[model samples]
Target: MSIEKFIQDGVTGWMSAHGEHSDIVMSTRIRLARNLTGYRFPIAFTEDDAMAVDRAASGVLLDTNQPNYSYMKMSEIPSLERLVLIEKHLISPHLANPERHGAVLLSEDETVSVMVNEEDHIRIQCIYPGLQLEDAYKKADEVDNLLESELPYAFDESFGYMTSCPSNTGTGMRASVMMHLPALTITKQIERIIPAISRLGIVVRGSYGEGSDAPGNVYQVSNQTTLGKTEQEILVDLGNITSRLIAHERQSRELLIAKSRLALENRLFRSLGTIAYARLLPNGEAARCLSDVRLGIDLGIIQDVDMSILNELMIFMQPGFLQQYAGTELSQEERDVFRAKLFRERLNIANAPASLEEDREE
Candidate 1:
């Protein structure tokens, strides 16, 4: 039997049963665009640093009077170790999940009241019941001064000196959140909600954040305000949108779960096929383990050659090693030859013997 085909078939069977994970469509929140008046600062951070900043921004770090960024732990990514903390931060909590806002400092004197900056624009953001509209607006304005000071040199030329992107020249703050609501969209009633949300300065995008979703199951809510509404007024309308976000998430969750279940039917899913094929291999896990040892020995590749030997080498072992003193082994040369052959075979598909592919071609 073809080793590759067997592995594929076995893996497919196993995964179909386990691959259909129970899904939950959650409401995701983030700051989008804003009126950046009286602000001077850097543009977006590097991707890695931005992600770290994203985690930091969700929590309530500073209180209103001396509102500033609260220093939290460094980012988990080791590569960005020397990176300085970005000025913005937040703390998000859901009615059905954790509820926190802004990053509060754990000071040496106490566990609060430290500041990261003095000026920036503020905007309220919420996609659930726990954070009320009043509190959301209040919290947003607290950080209005963060952008007043000097920014990193990176923001100097391309996006600098009050001539940044045309839409956000002053008070550079953008607010938005992810919402899932299909029933309204499916029944075509969503068109009605759009005019209302648009009137409130909100723009909606499709699934995964862009383009239109004909099914209208998911949407990203973002700001489109240009009429000089106060942060309070903007959030009042936004808060109205957030309050309705929960209902949308529930419907989306059910649809996703149903979709996953259908993907699992009849072993058509790739994940299921992979597992089924693995189990059906001739040596099963054991045969491959022996072959690996043989190839390693042949290629003169010892444990030192591949630092990834621990878990990967023993991922799946056959029953023979424990039963017999003779374990599967290969010389260094053998391993090299095997690898070369695999590539050669792949390149010369027509050279393969009179097999199934040829039969089909005929």
Candidate 2:
């Protein structure tokens, strides 16, 4: 699909807000880091080497004869369009780098993307709505098998799949689940949970993964080490941890309702009011407000808004998506204005007051 079509269609598939634990779990992603045999890793690649790798990987994907598959080189795509791809999680920040020579092959549904000449020779990624780690891994493995059939992979009998990073040398898989833990964060339980999980070979990262901040109280929890575990083992371990997190978050939510129901309601309604009526919304403030509003919806404190709209807003509120949707480049201040307007329109807050009153009466 063309980037224009992708932007116009908005969020779908994994970002559609449907699946198990959709209230807490935003999505699950499985990424496999791989390198082709007989080539230097991407870090050492010259322009010629990078081009060759891209050609080989993109060629394999194109030759698959799947009508839904679309491939675009980073250089050929506009910088804004590239940023949109990153916002949608169709491509990574690294692949969108101007200095990097790479291309991305995407499925029409936007669930699967294979990045060529990224940190590794091939980075196969599959994302599913909510907590579907096993399903995501199944799809990713299918793509991996198809690519391995056409191109040689750097694999060792003892070490499993070979990757550019030694940490990913074993199964080359990174399984992650994105969760919105407003209750945990608000109650200050996340501070205790992060270190506890880290001890269990699990790491917590911001929404967009490593080195990014977690806006909207969203966090990405993933397995930290892949060197000693099988892919199935990694998935199982992460799944167990994710289930526990969901339980903890739900418990925390219930605790908030029991201990400070009025205060919680006030906070959520105030957030809803801010997003629905404010004329200017900064990205960070927008995220926090939306996060509270989402919590309200999940807890039956708000009923007028759909969860899917909130999910889409999580992406749309970003600078890249806001600019793309407006069909123009925006300064930081301009983006804030456009973002507020977008939120009001999407929320359709005309009946929100009645909905809020009705919810409170219950």
TM-score leader: 2
How far is 69's C-alpha from truth in model 1 (Å)? 6.7
Identify the runs in model 1 with alpha carbons over 4 angstroms from their true place.
1-131, 145-163, 191-196, 206-216, 240-362
- Candidate 1 yields a Cα-based lDDT of 0.32
| Tens-digit lDDT string for candidate 1 (209-250) | 345442214355766742345455656666567666555544
TM-score for each candidate, following the candidate numbering? 0.33, 0.95
lDDT of 2 by residue, 144-229 (tens): 99889989899999998888888888999999999999999999999999999999999999989999989999999999989889
What lDDT score is found at residue 214 in candidate 2? 90
lDDT of 2: 0.89
Q: CA RMSD for every model? A: 19.5, 5.3
